[model samples]
Target: MLSDVLRSVRLTGSMLFLVDATTPWRSWAPQTEAFRRVVLPGSQHMVSYHVVTRGRCWAGLRDAPPESFETGDVLVIPHGDAYFLANPPDARASYGPEEAVAFFRQMAAGELPSVVPEGGGGAQQTQFICGFLGCDRRPFNPVLASLPRMIHLRGATALDGAMRHLVDFALCELREPAPGGKDVQLRLAELMFIEVVRRCLTTMAATQAGWLAGLGEPMVARALTLLHGAPARHWTLAELATQAGASRSVLAERFVQFVGQPPMQYLIQWRMQLATRMLAEPGAKVSGVAAALGYQSESAFSRAFKKCAGAAPGGWRRQPSE
Candidate 1:
Protein backbone atom coordinates (compact mmCIF):
# COMPACT_ATOMS: atom_id res chain seq x y z
CA MET A 1 0.00 0.00 0.00
CA LEU A 2 2.77 2.42 0.91
CA SER A 3 4.58 1.42 -2.29
CA ASP A 4 1.50 2.29 -4.35
CA VAL A 5 1.27 5.80 -2.94
CA LEU A 6 5.00 6.40 -3.36
CA ARG A 7 4.95 5.29 -6.99
CA SER A 8 1.91 7.44 -7.75
CA VAL A 9 3.59 10.46 -6.16
CA ARG A 10 6.57 10.09 -8.54
CA LEU A 11 9.41 10.33 -6.04
CA THR A 12 12.59 11.67 -7.64
CA GLY A 13 15.80 11.93 -5.64
CA SER A 14 18.80 13.89 -6.91
CA MET A 15 22.07 15.87 -6.29
CA LEU A 16 23.12 13.95 -3.15
CA PHE A 17 26.62 14.86 -1.97
CA LEU A 18 28.82 14.94 1.10
CA VAL A 19 29.57 18.24 2.84
CA ASP A 20 32.65 18.81 5.01
CA ALA A 21 32.60 22.04 7.02
CA THR A 22 34.98 23.63 9.50
CA THR A 23 33.97 25.28 12.78
CA PRO A 24 31.92 28.52 12.85
CA TRP A 25 30.26 27.61 9.53
CA ARG A 26 26.60 27.83 8.70
CA SER A 27 24.74 26.64 5.57
CA TRP A 28 21.25 27.85 4.77
CA ALA A 29 18.62 25.73 3.11
CA PRO A 30 16.81 28.34 1.05
CA GLN A 31 13.02 28.35 0.95
CA THR A 32 12.13 25.48 -1.39
CA GLU A 33 10.01 27.64 -3.70
CA ALA A 34 13.10 29.77 -4.38
CA PHE A 35 15.59 26.95 -4.80
CA ARG A 36 13.64 23.91 -6.09
CA ARG A 37 14.17 24.60 -9.77
CA VAL A 38 17.84 25.11 -9.07
CA VAL A 39 17.87 21.61 -7.66
CA LEU A 40 15.18 19.58 -9.42
CA PRO A 41 13.42 21.15 -12.41
CA GLY A 42 9.64 20.77 -12.95
CA SER A 43 9.16 19.27 -9.50
CA GLN A 44 5.99 20.18 -7.58
CA HIS A 45 7.40 19.57 -4.07
CA MET A 46 10.94 19.53 -2.69
CA VAL A 47 12.27 18.06 0.58
CA SER A 48 15.75 18.62 1.97
CA TYR A 49 17.35 16.19 4.44
CA HIS A 50 20.82 15.95 5.92
CA VAL A 51 22.42 12.76 7.30
CA VAL A 52 24.98 13.40 10.00
CA THR A 53 27.75 10.99 9.16
CA ARG A 54 30.44 12.48 11.39
CA GLY A 55 30.82 15.09 14.14
CA ARG A 56 28.03 17.27 15.51
CA CYS A 57 25.99 20.30 14.45
CA TRP A 58 22.95 22.47 15.25
CA ALA A 59 19.81 22.52 13.07
CA GLY A 60 16.44 24.24 13.21
CA LEU A 61 14.14 26.61 11.38
CA ARG A 62 15.31 30.20 11.16
CA ASP A 63 14.97 32.07 14.54
CA ALA A 64 13.85 28.86 16.29
CA PRO A 65 15.79 27.34 19.16
CA PRO A 66 18.25 25.07 17.40
CA GLU A 67 18.53 21.40 18.33
CA SER A 68 21.84 19.70 18.85
CA PHE A 69 22.53 16.71 16.55
CA GLU A 70 25.52 14.46 16.40
CA THR A 71 26.79 11.62 14.22
CA GLY A 72 24.05 9.13 13.21
CA ASP A 73 21.41 11.87 13.38
CA VAL A 74 19.10 13.05 10.56
CA LEU A 75 17.37 16.38 10.14
CA VAL A 76 14.51 16.57 7.66
CA ILE A 77 12.81 19.70 6.40
CA PRO A 78 9.82 17.91 4.98
CA HIS A 79 8.04 20.94 3.55
CA GLY A 80 11.18 22.68 2.34
CA ASP A 81 10.84 25.53 4.82
CA ALA A 82 13.95 27.69 5.16
CA TYR A 83 16.42 26.14 7.63
CA PHE A 84 20.07 26.21 8.61
CA LEU A 85 22.81 23.89 9.87
CA ALA A 86 25.87 25.14 11.71
CA ASN A 87 28.51 24.19 14.24
CA PRO A 88 26.76 26.64 16.55
CA PRO A 89 22.99 26.41 15.90
CA ASP A 90 22.41 30.15 15.72
CA ALA A 91 25.53 31.06 13.73
CA ARG A 92 24.74 33.87 11.28
CA ALA A 93 24.65 32.72 7.68
CA SER A 94 27.52 34.10 5.58
CA TYR A 95 25.14 34.21 2.64
CA GLY A 96 21.46 34.94 2.08
CA PRO A 97 18.70 33.75 -0.32
CA GLU A 98 20.20 35.09 -3.57
CA GLU A 99 23.62 33.64 -2.80
CA ALA A 100 22.04 30.38 -1.71
CA VAL A 101 20.32 30.13 -5.10
CA ALA A 102 23.64 30.69 -6.85
CA PHE A 103 25.27 27.99 -4.75
CA PHE A 104 22.49 25.46 -5.50
CA ARG A 105 22.59 26.23 -9.23
CA GLN A 106 26.32 25.55 -9.38
CA MET A 107 26.00 22.41 -7.29
CA ALA A 108 23.21 21.05 -9.49
CA ALA A 109 25.24 21.87 -12.59
CA GLY A 110 28.02 19.64 -11.25
CA GLU A 111 30.45 22.53 -11.26
CA LEU A 112 31.31 21.82 -7.63
CA PRO A 113 33.25 18.80 -6.44
CA SER A 114 31.48 15.72 -5.04
CA VAL A 115 32.76 16.52 -1.53
CA VAL A 116 31.95 20.21 -0.94
CA PRO A 117 34.33 21.82 1.58
CA GLU A 118 33.11 24.99 3.32
CA GLY A 119 33.53 27.39 6.29
CA GLY A 120 36.50 28.95 8.11
CA GLY A 121 39.66 26.83 7.79
CA GLY A 122 39.56 26.02 11.50
CA ALA A 123 40.81 22.69 12.89
CA GLN A 124 37.37 21.58 14.11
CA GLN A 125 35.11 19.99 11.49
CA THR A 126 31.67 18.42 10.99
CA GLN A 127 30.54 16.34 8.02
CA PHE A 128 27.15 15.27 6.64
CA ILE A 129 25.60 14.10 3.40
CA CYS A 130 22.99 16.42 1.94
CA GLY A 131 20.21 15.05 -0.24
CA PHE A 132 17.21 16.56 -2.05
CA LEU A 133 14.08 14.90 -3.41
CA GLY A 134 11.00 16.05 -5.35
CA CYS A 135 7.56 14.58 -5.80
CA ASP A 136 4.02 15.38 -6.92
CA ARG A 137 2.04 17.30 -4.31
CA ARG A 138 -1.08 18.02 -6.25
CA PRO A 139 -4.10 15.67 -6.54
CA PHE A 140 -2.93 13.52 -3.59
CA ASN A 141 0.18 13.06 -1.42
CA PRO A 142 -0.56 11.74 2.05
CA VAL A 143 3.01 10.91 3.00
CA LEU A 144 4.29 14.47 2.91
CA ALA A 145 1.10 15.85 4.42
CA SER A 146 1.50 13.55 7.43
CA LEU A 147 4.94 14.89 8.33
CA PRO A 148 5.72 18.01 10.32
CA ARG A 149 7.71 20.99 9.00
CA MET A 150 10.79 19.67 10.77
CA ILE A 151 11.71 16.09 11.86
CA HIS A 152 14.72 15.49 14.09
CA LEU A 153 15.82 11.85 14.54
CA ARG A 154 18.25 11.34 17.39
CA GLY A 155 21.20 8.89 17.13
CA ALA A 156 21.00 7.11 20.45
CA THR A 157 18.37 4.47 19.56
CA ALA A 158 17.83 1.50 17.26
CA LEU A 159 16.48 3.55 14.36
CA ASP A 160 19.54 5.75 14.57
CA GLY A 161 21.97 2.80 14.45
CA ALA A 162 20.26 1.43 11.32
CA MET A 163 20.25 4.79 9.52
CA ARG A 164 23.90 5.40 10.35
CA HIS A 165 24.97 2.10 8.81
CA LEU A 166 22.93 2.61 5.63
CA VAL A 167 24.36 6.11 5.24
CA ASP A 168 27.90 4.88 5.89
CA PHE A 169 27.53 2.24 3.15
CA ALA A 170 26.16 4.82 0.69
CA LEU A 171 28.98 7.23 1.50
CA CYS A 172 31.53 4.50 0.93
CA GLU A 173 30.10 3.73 -2.52
CA LEU A 174 30.35 7.41 -3.48
CA ARG A 175 33.82 7.82 -2.04
CA GLU A 176 35.11 5.47 -4.71
CA PRO A 177 33.06 5.60 -7.89
CA ALA A 178 32.45 2.09 -9.20
CA PRO A 179 31.03 1.02 -12.57
CA GLY A 180 27.48 1.74 -11.40
CA GLY A 181 28.23 4.01 -8.43
CA LYS A 182 25.80 6.79 -9.32
CA ASP A 183 22.92 4.42 -9.86
CA VAL A 184 23.68 2.65 -6.59
CA GLN A 185 23.87 5.95 -4.73
CA LEU A 186 20.50 7.07 -6.09
CA ARG A 187 18.80 3.83 -5.04
CA LEU A 188 20.46 4.02 -1.62
CA ALA A 189 19.26 7.57 -1.21
CA GLU A 190 15.69 6.58 -1.99
CA LEU A 191 15.87 3.64 0.41
CA MET A 192 17.34 5.79 3.18
CA PHE A 193 14.53 8.34 2.78
CA ILE A 194 11.94 5.59 2.98
CA GLU A 195 13.60 4.30 6.14
CA VAL A 196 13.47 7.76 7.67
CA VAL A 197 9.74 7.99 6.96
CA ARG A 198 9.12 4.55 8.47
CA ARG A 199 10.98 5.56 11.60
CA CYS A 200 8.74 8.60 11.85
CA LEU A 201 5.63 6.44 11.79
CA THR A 202 6.97 3.96 14.34
CA THR A 203 7.92 6.77 16.65
CA MET A 204 4.71 8.78 16.22
CA ALA A 205 2.80 9.55 19.42
CA ALA A 206 -0.52 7.81 19.98
CA THR A 207 -2.19 11.20 19.89
CA GLN A 208 -1.02 11.94 16.36
CA ALA A 209 -3.67 12.17 13.66
CA GLY A 210 -2.85 11.77 9.96
CA TRP A 211 -2.81 9.22 7.17
CA LEU A 212 0.53 7.77 8.25
CA ALA A 213 -0.67 7.55 11.82
CA GLY A 214 -3.78 5.75 10.60
CA LEU A 215 -1.58 2.91 9.37
CA GLY A 216 -1.01 2.06 13.01
CA GLU A 217 -4.75 1.80 13.76
CA PRO A 218 -5.95 -1.73 13.24
CA MET A 219 -9.36 -0.92 11.78
CA VAL A 220 -8.27 2.13 9.77
CA ALA A 221 -5.19 0.32 8.58
CA ARG A 222 -7.23 -2.63 7.37
CA ALA A 223 -9.58 -0.43 5.39
CA LEU A 224 -6.70 1.54 3.85
CA THR A 225 -4.89 -1.65 2.92
CA LEU A 226 -7.96 -2.89 1.13
CA LEU A 227 -8.63 0.42 -0.63
CA HIS A 228 -5.08 0.77 -1.86
CA GLY A 229 -4.85 -2.88 -2.83
CA ALA A 230 -7.95 -2.91 -5.04
CA PRO A 231 -8.75 0.67 -5.99
CA ALA A 232 -10.53 -0.50 -9.11
CA ARG A 233 -13.01 -2.61 -7.18
CA HIS A 234 -16.54 -1.26 -6.82
CA TRP A 235 -16.59 -1.37 -3.02
CA THR A 236 -19.70 -0.45 -1.09
CA LEU A 237 -19.63 0.87 2.48
CA ALA A 238 -21.23 -2.30 3.83
CA GLU A 239 -18.97 -4.61 1.84
CA LEU A 240 -15.86 -2.70 2.87
CA ALA A 241 -16.93 -2.74 6.49
CA THR A 242 -17.56 -6.45 6.37
CA GLN A 243 -14.16 -7.05 4.83
CA ALA A 244 -12.55 -4.91 7.55
CA GLY A 245 -14.52 -6.66 10.32
CA ALA A 246 -16.29 -3.47 11.47
CA SER A 247 -19.74 -1.93 11.21
CA ARG A 248 -20.34 0.71 8.50
CA SER A 249 -20.86 3.57 11.00
CA VAL A 250 -17.76 2.80 13.03
CA LEU A 251 -15.68 2.37 9.89
CA ALA A 252 -16.84 5.68 8.46
CA GLU A 253 -16.12 7.56 11.65
CA ARG A 254 -12.64 6.09 12.07
CA PHE A 255 -11.79 6.66 8.41
CA VAL A 256 -12.91 10.26 8.67
CA GLN A 257 -11.00 10.80 11.88
CA PHE A 258 -7.73 9.44 10.53
CA VAL A 259 -7.92 10.02 6.75
CA GLY A 260 -10.14 13.10 6.70
CA GLN A 261 -12.62 11.24 4.47
CA PRO A 262 -14.93 8.25 4.38
CA PRO A 263 -13.92 4.98 2.75
CA MET A 264 -15.82 5.58 -0.52
CA GLN A 265 -14.53 9.13 -0.81
CA TYR A 266 -10.94 8.00 -0.33
CA LEU A 267 -11.50 5.42 -3.05
CA ILE A 268 -12.52 8.15 -5.49
CA GLN A 269 -9.42 10.25 -4.73
CA TRP A 270 -7.14 7.25 -4.97
CA ARG A 271 -8.71 6.30 -8.30
CA MET A 272 -8.23 9.80 -9.61
CA GLN A 273 -4.58 9.63 -8.62
CA LEU A 274 -4.21 6.43 -10.64
CA ALA A 275 -6.16 8.01 -13.48
CA THR A 276 -3.86 11.04 -13.58
CA ARG A 277 -0.82 8.79 -13.80
CA MET A 278 -2.34 6.84 -16.65
CA LEU A 279 -3.50 9.95 -18.50
CA ALA A 280 0.09 11.21 -18.52
CA GLU A 281 1.23 8.24 -20.57
CA PRO A 282 1.70 8.51 -24.33
CA GLY A 283 -1.42 7.90 -26.45
CA ALA A 284 -3.62 7.44 -23.35
CA LYS A 285 -7.32 8.02 -23.96
CA VAL A 286 -9.96 9.23 -21.54
CA SER A 287 -12.39 6.40 -22.32
CA GLY A 288 -9.66 3.79 -21.95
CA VAL A 289 -8.56 5.18 -18.62
CA ALA A 290 -12.15 5.41 -17.43
CA ALA A 291 -12.87 1.80 -18.27
CA ALA A 292 -9.63 0.61 -16.70
CA LEU A 293 -10.44 2.32 -13.44
CA GLY A 294 -14.00 0.78 -13.37
CA TYR A 295 -15.91 3.87 -14.42
CA GLN A 296 -18.94 2.92 -16.54
CA SER A 297 -18.16 5.60 -19.14
CA GLU A 298 -15.73 8.36 -20.05
CA SER A 299 -18.31 11.03 -19.12
CA ALA A 300 -18.71 9.60 -15.61
CA PHE A 301 -14.97 9.46 -15.10
CA SER A 302 -14.58 13.06 -16.38
CA ARG A 303 -17.18 14.28 -13.89
CA ALA A 304 -15.44 12.62 -10.95
CA PHE A 305 -12.06 13.91 -12.12
CA LYS A 306 -13.32 17.48 -12.35
CA LYS A 307 -14.98 17.28 -8.92
CA CYS A 308 -11.89 15.96 -7.20
CA ALA A 309 -9.23 17.89 -9.19
CA GLY A 310 -11.11 21.10 -10.05
CA ALA A 311 -10.54 20.43 -13.77
CA ALA A 312 -11.88 18.11 -16.42
CA PRO A 313 -9.92 14.98 -17.17
CA GLY A 314 -8.64 16.06 -20.58
CA GLY A 315 -7.87 19.59 -19.50
CA TRP A 316 -6.13 18.45 -16.33
CA ARG A 317 -4.03 15.94 -18.26
CA ARG A 318 -3.08 18.64 -20.77
CA GLN A 319 -1.95 20.96 -17.99
CA PRO A 320 1.75 21.87 -18.05
CA SER A 321 2.01 21.26 -14.33
CA GLU A 322 0.55 17.79 -14.70
Candidate 2:
Protein backbone atom coordinates (compact mmCIF):
# COMPACT_ATOMS: atom_id res chain seq x y z
CA MET A 1 0.00 0.00 0.00
CA LEU A 2 1.16 3.59 -0.69
CA SER A 3 0.83 4.54 2.96
CA ASP A 4 2.77 1.51 4.06
CA VAL A 5 5.36 2.29 1.41
CA LEU A 6 5.54 5.86 2.66
CA ARG A 7 5.82 4.68 6.24
CA SER A 8 8.79 2.62 5.24
CA VAL A 9 10.31 5.61 3.46
CA ARG A 10 9.87 7.96 6.39
CA LEU A 11 10.88 5.38 8.98
CA THR A 12 14.13 5.10 7.09
CA GLY A 13 15.29 8.62 7.80
CA SER A 14 15.35 11.71 9.93
CA MET A 15 15.33 15.13 8.56
CA LEU A 16 16.24 23.79 9.73
CA PHE A 17 15.52 27.68 9.23
CA LEU A 18 15.13 31.20 8.15
CA VAL A 19 13.90 33.89 10.55
CA ASP A 20 11.00 35.51 8.76
CA ALA A 21 9.91 37.12 12.00
CA THR A 22 6.24 36.33 11.66
CA THR A 23 3.53 35.05 13.91
CA PRO A 24 3.55 31.24 14.33
CA TRP A 25 0.45 29.13 13.91
CA ARG A 26 -1.90 29.18 16.83
CA SER A 27 -1.58 25.41 16.99
CA TRP A 28 0.87 22.69 16.04
CA ALA A 29 0.84 18.92 15.59
CA PRO A 30 3.43 16.34 14.80
CA GLN A 31 2.93 14.84 11.34
CA THR A 32 2.84 11.54 13.11
CA GLU A 33 0.49 12.69 15.84
CA ALA A 34 -1.92 15.00 14.00
CA PHE A 35 -1.97 15.67 10.26
CA ARG A 36 -3.63 14.72 6.97
CA ARG A 37 -1.94 13.53 3.78
CA VAL A 38 -4.00 14.13 0.65
CA VAL A 39 -3.43 12.47 -2.70
CA LEU A 40 -4.17 14.59 -5.71
CA PRO A 41 -4.82 13.06 -9.10
CA GLY A 42 -3.42 13.83 -12.55
CA SER A 43 -0.73 16.36 -13.53
CA GLN A 44 -1.74 19.33 -11.44
CA HIS A 45 1.12 21.34 -9.98
CA MET A 46 0.52 21.19 -6.26
CA VAL A 47 2.58 19.65 -3.48
CA SER A 48 1.00 18.26 -0.33
CA TYR A 49 2.68 19.39 2.88
CA HIS A 50 2.60 17.68 6.25
CA VAL A 51 4.16 18.71 9.55
CA VAL A 52 4.88 15.54 11.46
CA THR A 53 4.72 16.56 15.05
CA ARG A 54 3.43 13.17 16.10
CA GLY A 55 3.08 10.30 13.62
CA ARG A 56 4.00 9.13 10.14
CA CYS A 57 2.81 9.72 6.54
CA TRP A 58 3.48 8.83 2.91
CA ALA A 59 4.43 11.07 -0.03
CA GLY A 60 4.24 10.09 -3.72
CA LEU A 61 5.10 11.95 -6.91
CA ARG A 62 4.31 11.22 -10.54
CA ASP A 63 7.95 10.37 -11.03
CA ALA A 64 10.89 9.56 -8.81
CA PRO A 65 8.62 9.09 -5.81
CA PRO A 66 9.92 9.42 -2.22
CA GLU A 67 10.04 6.97 0.66
CA SER A 68 7.56 7.20 3.54
CA PHE A 69 7.98 9.89 6.18
CA GLU A 70 7.66 9.71 9.94
CA THR A 71 8.20 11.84 13.03
CA GLY A 72 11.26 14.07 12.84
CA ASP A 73 10.88 13.89 9.08
CA VAL A 74 9.65 16.83 7.01
CA LEU A 75 8.46 16.07 3.46
CA VAL A 76 8.72 18.72 0.75
CA ILE A 77 6.55 18.37 -2.35
CA PRO A 78 8.21 21.17 -4.24
CA HIS A 79 5.63 21.13 -7.04
CA GLY A 80 2.65 21.08 -4.68
CA ASP A 81 1.13 18.27 -6.67
CA ALA A 82 -1.09 15.69 -5.08
CA TYR A 83 0.15 12.36 -3.70
CA PHE A 84 -1.18 9.68 -1.41
CA LEU A 85 -0.89 9.50 2.37
CA ALA A 86 -2.54 6.90 4.50
CA ASN A 87 -2.17 5.13 7.81
CA PRO A 88 -3.72 1.83 6.83
CA PRO A 89 -1.31 -0.83 5.67
CA ASP A 90 -3.17 -1.11 2.39
CA ALA A 91 -3.00 2.16 0.42
CA ARG A 92 -5.13 0.78 -2.40
CA ALA A 93 -8.08 0.26 -0.06
CA SER A 94 -7.83 3.89 1.03
CA TYR A 95 -7.51 5.46 -2.44
CA GLY A 96 -10.32 6.45 -4.80
CA PRO A 97 -11.64 9.86 -5.85
CA GLU A 98 -14.83 9.46 -3.88
CA GLU A 99 -12.90 8.11 -0.91
CA ALA A 100 -10.56 11.07 -1.10
CA VAL A 101 -13.39 13.58 -1.12
CA ALA A 102 -14.98 11.86 1.83
CA PHE A 103 -11.65 11.68 3.58
CA PHE A 104 -11.13 15.40 3.21
CA ARG A 105 -14.65 16.17 4.38
CA GLN A 106 -14.20 13.94 7.39
CA MET A 107 -10.88 15.56 8.05
CA ALA A 108 -12.54 18.96 7.93
CA ALA A 109 -15.25 17.65 10.20
CA GLY A 110 -12.71 16.06 12.55
CA GLU A 111 -13.98 12.65 11.61
CA LEU A 112 -11.35 11.29 9.24
CA PRO A 113 -10.34 7.88 10.51
CA SER A 114 -6.87 7.44 11.93
CA VAL A 115 -4.27 5.20 10.30
CA VAL A 116 -5.26 2.44 12.65
CA PRO A 117 -9.03 2.59 12.28
CA GLU A 118 -11.13 0.91 14.94
CA GLY A 119 -11.29 -2.90 14.63
CA GLY A 120 -9.03 -2.77 11.60
CA GLY A 121 -5.67 -3.32 13.18
CA GLY A 122 -3.84 -3.15 16.47
CA ALA A 123 -0.98 -1.21 14.87
CA GLN A 124 0.06 1.91 16.71
CA GLN A 125 -1.59 5.02 15.36
CA THR A 126 0.48 7.61 13.48
CA GLN A 127 -0.23 11.35 13.07
CA PHE A 128 0.30 13.60 10.08
CA ILE A 129 0.51 17.38 9.84
CA CYS A 130 -0.63 18.95 6.58
CA GLY A 131 -0.02 22.21 4.70
CA PHE A 132 0.91 23.70 1.31
CA LEU A 133 4.08 24.40 -0.68
CA GLY A 134 3.61 27.03 -3.36
CA CYS A 135 5.21 29.81 -5.39
CA ASP A 136 4.48 31.74 -8.56
CA ARG A 137 4.92 29.58 -11.69
CA ARG A 138 6.03 32.17 -14.14
CA PRO A 139 9.16 33.32 -15.95
CA PHE A 140 10.34 29.77 -15.44
CA ASN A 141 11.84 27.96 -12.43
CA PRO A 142 14.82 26.11 -13.86
CA VAL A 143 15.37 24.15 -10.70
CA LEU A 144 11.82 22.92 -10.64
CA ALA A 145 11.89 22.37 -14.36
CA SER A 146 14.79 19.97 -14.03
CA LEU A 147 13.23 18.05 -11.21
CA PRO A 148 10.87 15.14 -11.74
CA ARG A 149 7.30 15.51 -10.46
CA MET A 150 8.09 13.86 -7.12
CA ILE A 151 11.22 13.44 -4.98
CA HIS A 152 11.64 11.68 -1.66
CA LEU A 153 14.76 11.27 0.45
CA ARG A 154 14.85 9.13 3.58
CA GLY A 155 15.47 11.19 6.71
CA ALA A 156 17.69 8.40 8.05
CA THR A 157 20.96 9.84 6.83
CA ALA A 158 23.51 10.97 9.39
CA LEU A 159 23.14 14.49 8.05
CA ASP A 160 19.43 14.58 8.88
CA GLY A 161 19.97 13.88 12.61
CA ALA A 162 20.58 17.51 13.50
CA MET A 163 17.54 18.47 11.46
CA ARG A 164 15.46 15.97 13.40
CA HIS A 165 16.50 17.65 16.62
CA LEU A 166 15.66 21.02 15.17
CA VAL A 167 12.14 19.81 14.48
CA ASP A 168 11.85 18.43 18.00
CA PHE A 169 13.02 21.72 19.41
CA ALA A 170 10.51 23.60 17.27
CA LEU A 171 7.75 21.34 18.52
CA CYS A 172 8.75 22.14 22.07
CA GLU A 173 8.73 25.85 21.33
CA LEU A 174 5.28 25.55 19.73
CA ARG A 175 3.98 23.61 22.70
CA GLU A 176 4.65 26.55 24.94
CA PRO A 177 2.85 29.66 23.83
CA ALA A 178 5.24 32.54 23.99
CA PRO A 179 5.91 35.88 22.38
CA GLY A 180 7.70 34.39 19.36
CA GLY A 181 6.83 30.74 19.19
CA LYS A 182 5.17 31.07 15.81
CA ASP A 183 8.09 33.06 14.51
CA VAL A 184 10.45 30.40 15.71
CA GLN A 185 8.38 27.63 14.10
CA LEU A 186 8.32 29.42 10.79
CA ARG A 187 12.08 29.89 10.92
CA LEU A 188 12.54 26.28 11.88
CA ALA A 189 10.37 25.19 8.96
CA GLU A 190 12.63 27.07 6.63
CA LEU A 191 15.66 25.44 8.18
CA MET A 192 14.08 22.05 7.73
CA PHE A 193 13.58 22.83 4.04
CA ILE A 194 17.24 23.76 3.59
CA GLU A 195 18.37 20.50 5.14
CA VAL A 196 16.13 18.49 2.84
CA VAL A 197 17.47 20.31 -0.17
CA ARG A 198 21.01 19.63 0.95
CA ARG A 199 20.29 15.93 1.16
CA CYS A 200 18.52 15.94 -2.18
CA LEU A 201 21.49 17.63 -3.75
CA THR A 202 23.73 15.01 -2.24
CA THR A 203 21.52 12.26 -3.66
CA MET A 204 21.56 13.92 -7.04
CA ALA A 205 25.33 14.14 -6.92
CA ALA A 206 25.47 10.37 -6.69
CA THR A 207 22.92 9.68 -9.40
CA GLN A 208 23.48 8.95 -13.07
CA ALA A 209 21.02 11.53 -14.41
CA GLY A 210 19.55 14.77 -13.01
CA TRP A 211 21.09 18.05 -11.98
CA LEU A 212 23.36 16.48 -9.39
CA ALA A 213 24.89 14.25 -12.00
CA GLY A 214 25.50 17.27 -14.15
CA LEU A 215 26.86 19.21 -11.23
CA GLY A 216 29.01 16.33 -10.02
CA GLU A 217 30.60 15.51 -13.35
CA PRO A 218 34.24 16.54 -13.17
CA MET A 219 34.06 18.71 -16.26
CA VAL A 220 30.70 20.24 -15.49
CA ALA A 221 31.42 20.48 -11.80
CA ARG A 222 34.60 22.31 -12.60
CA ALA A 223 32.72 24.84 -14.69
CA LEU A 224 30.07 25.26 -12.00
CA THR A 225 32.69 25.45 -9.27
CA LEU A 226 34.63 28.08 -11.16
CA LEU A 227 31.54 30.07 -11.92
CA HIS A 228 30.44 29.84 -8.32
CA GLY A 229 33.96 30.24 -6.99
CA ALA A 230 34.73 33.28 -9.11
CA PRO A 231 31.76 34.59 -11.07
CA ALA A 232 33.69 37.81 -11.58
CA ARG A 233 35.94 36.06 -14.02
CA HIS A 234 35.04 37.31 -17.48
CA TRP A 235 34.18 33.80 -18.59
CA THR A 236 33.71 33.20 -22.27
CA LEU A 237 32.54 29.96 -23.81
CA ALA A 238 36.08 29.17 -24.86
CA GLU A 239 37.51 29.77 -21.37
CA LEU A 240 34.68 27.85 -19.70
CA ALA A 241 35.13 25.00 -22.13
CA THR A 242 38.86 24.99 -21.49
CA GLN A 243 38.30 24.97 -17.73
CA ALA A 244 35.82 22.12 -18.11
CA GLY A 245 38.16 20.27 -20.49
CA ALA A 246 35.50 19.95 -23.15
CA SER A 247 34.90 21.44 -26.53
CA ARG A 248 32.45 24.34 -26.73
CA SER A 249 29.80 22.20 -28.40
CA VAL A 250 30.21 19.38 -25.91
CA LEU A 251 30.04 21.74 -22.96
CA ALA A 252 26.97 23.50 -24.28
CA GLU A 253 25.12 20.33 -25.16
CA ARG A 254 25.91 18.37 -21.99
CA PHE A 255 25.12 21.30 -19.75
CA VAL A 256 21.75 21.83 -21.38
CA GLN A 257 20.85 18.15 -21.31
CA PHE A 258 21.94 17.33 -17.79
CA VAL A 259 22.13 20.63 -15.97
CA GLY A 260 18.95 21.96 -17.65
CA GLN A 261 20.66 25.05 -19.02
CA PRO A 262 23.57 26.11 -21.16
CA PRO A 263 26.80 26.63 -19.27
CA MET A 264 26.71 30.41 -19.59
CA GLN A 265 23.04 30.53 -18.74
CA TYR A 266 23.57 28.32 -15.71
CA LEU A 267 26.44 30.52 -14.60
CA ILE A 268 24.35 33.65 -14.83
CA GLN A 269 21.47 32.08 -13.00
CA TRP A 270 23.71 30.64 -10.31
CA ARG A 271 25.33 34.01 -9.79
CA MET A 272 21.93 35.60 -9.44
CA GLN A 273 20.82 32.95 -6.96
CA LEU A 274 23.95 33.56 -4.88
CA ALA A 275 23.57 37.30 -5.18
CA THR A 276 20.04 37.06 -3.87
CA ARG A 277 21.26 35.05 -0.89
CA MET A 278 23.99 37.58 -0.12
CA LEU A 279 21.66 40.52 -0.61
CA ALA A 280 19.33 39.14 2.05
CA GLU A 281 22.00 39.28 4.70
CA PRO A 282 21.92 42.27 6.99
CA GLY A 283 24.38 45.02 6.01
CA ALA A 284 25.41 43.27 2.81
CA LYS A 285 25.94 45.98 0.20
CA VAL A 286 24.95 45.76 -3.47
CA SER A 287 28.38 46.92 -4.56
CA GLY A 288 29.95 44.32 -2.33
CA VAL A 289 27.82 41.54 -3.75
CA ALA A 290 28.59 42.63 -7.28
CA ALA A 291 32.31 42.79 -6.56
CA ALA A 292 32.27 39.36 -4.99
CA LEU A 293 30.51 38.02 -8.09
CA GLY A 294 33.14 39.55 -10.38
CA TYR A 295 31.16 42.56 -11.41
CA GLN A 296 33.48 45.55 -11.49
CA SER A 297 30.73 48.11 -11.45
CA GLU A 298 27.47 48.05 -9.53
CA SER A 299 25.61 49.41 -12.56
CA ALA A 300 26.89 46.59 -14.73
CA PHE A 301 25.95 44.06 -12.12
CA SER A 302 22.52 45.62 -11.67
CA ARG A 303 21.79 45.41 -15.36
CA ALA A 304 22.73 41.77 -15.54
CA PHE A 305 20.88 40.96 -12.34
CA LYS A 306 17.80 42.79 -13.50
CA LYS A 307 17.93 41.04 -16.81
CA CYS A 308 18.01 37.67 -15.08
CA ALA A 309 16.00 38.29 -11.88
CA GLY A 310 13.59 40.94 -13.20
CA ALA A 311 14.32 43.16 -10.22
CA ALA A 312 16.97 45.67 -9.30
CA PRO A 313 19.58 44.60 -6.80
CA GLY A 314 18.54 47.28 -4.36
CA GLY A 315 14.88 46.39 -4.65
CA TRP A 316 15.65 42.72 -4.17
CA ARG A 317 17.79 43.58 -1.18
CA ARG A 318 15.11 45.79 0.36
CA GLN A 319 12.19 43.35 0.33
CA PRO A 320 11.87 40.88 3.25
CA SER A 321 13.61 38.48 0.93
CA GLU A 322 12.75 34.79 0.47
- Give the top-scoring candidate (lDDT): 1
TM-score of each: 0.93, 0.54
lDDT of 1 by residue, 200-232 (tens): 777763557788888989999999999888888
Whole-model lDDT, model 2: 0.52
The parts of candidate 1 lying over 4 Å away from their true place are 158-162
Which tens-of-lDDT digit does each residue in 1-322 have in candidate 2?
1122112112111111111111111111122211222322211233334445555544454343436666645555665455554443234332445554554445434343212222224354454434332232322344445455555555455225666676567555534546755445545554555455556666766664655566566777677666666666789999998887999998888777677778777667767766775776799999999999888899998998999878898876554312
RMSD (CA, Å), each prediction? 1.9, 11.2
Count of clashing residue pairs in every prediction: 0, 40
Query: In model 1, what is the error at residue 278, expressed in angstroms?
Result: 0.8
How many residue pairs of model 2 clash at the backbone? 40
